[model samples]
Target: MISSANILFEFICFVMALCFLKGNDKFTLFTKLYLGLVCITETSGFLWMMCTNKSNIWIFNIYILFEALYISFGLYHFIKPFKKNVKPLYIATYLIFIAVYLYGSFTRGFFKFQTTAIMVASVLIVFLCLYYYHNLMKSDKIISIRNNLGFWWVAAVLFFYFGSTVYNLFMNVIFSNKPFAYEILVYIMLTLNAILYGIWSYSFICSSRHQKLLTSSY
Candidate 1:
């Protein structure tokens, strides 16, 4: 039987492919790219884990690296169309995260150090998201698109990502020695991730539909 992680990884990849194929607009295109990269990296990690009999620490390490890169790219695309000045800061931050992950992976045990880094990173990301939203609101740039879908989508992503991050940290720190418990929680987290991705995909569709309607009315 295929592992749960493998199954979910395949499903995510399939969904990402469909999103890419159907995406015609720039917004959808960026979303497709972001999700596609995430799915690819995750699937690769899972495959590596299975092939190596779940003993290869490097797979998870590389997975975290890809994840950090994905977030960096997603944030870049998210702010690029509206606020170009933030691009350099985002790039710098991305490089810092890559360096940190590489250092931790090579010097420390992959899962343990990766978990610690992710927990810290998640908190920082949440703060950044809040800052972005606050600035947009203050500038009176919180128009219909920003109000209706953009803010909510960002919130959803942050919520789910952080939620999963917290669970991962807990599994690593609290249940590290309990293999069965750790495995169960990991599966649960994977399911949550799938649900989060589904919600994100739905939000993308809604945003696309809204734009199409506005275009038609013009």
Candidate 2:
């Protein structure tokens, strides 16, 4: 099942964050926290489904709120190094997300999947990822992408959301028209999760090595 693989990946990322990144920086601390929440949410959702044989949409509905906010904050953290006066943009992004989320919740109900809200969020995140890349390219400072945890982390985010855009956009159509739709969707999700968690695990390794080097140099 997707949850089995997803939970394993999330647990690995969470452990790496704790061992290598906890207290390393504000961003990493938050990342660790976020990963912990992800693990818990995924497990809980899985258990809820197994035990109650009911939809866990409400759990994900709540989790998505945290997910969007944390991702926005992460992007803001990365982008702030290159651009000043970005707080307003960050705030504006939250406002837009909240507006959409509330509207979706009202229209679709809290227990529904809220596809429209997620779609809006995915689009916003993709654009923000592009903006971050643009700023990264324009900056004068030389960066070592190999050891840059932020770069790799953002790259994972970019790949997952941007890569999933088409799938997300036509998810209903695919389910309606395609054979083995559930299997196809699961495979897609697994691939996306592998990409995301693989990069994240590597970033944590880079963070650990980078920290060790920093310590040795001091």
**Whole-model Cα lDDT per candidate?**
0.61, 0.86
lDDT (C-alpha) at residue 10 in model 2: 89
Best model number under TM-score: 2
**Clash pairs (backbone) in predicted model 1:** none
TM-score for each of the candidates: 0.75, 0.94
Best by lDDT: 2
Write model 1 residue lDDT over 23-60, tens digit each, in one string.
46555565566566666666676677777766545655
Cα lDDT tens digits, model 2, 102-160, are: 99899879987777788888889989989999999999989888788889888999999
- In TM-score terms, candidate 1 sits at 0.75
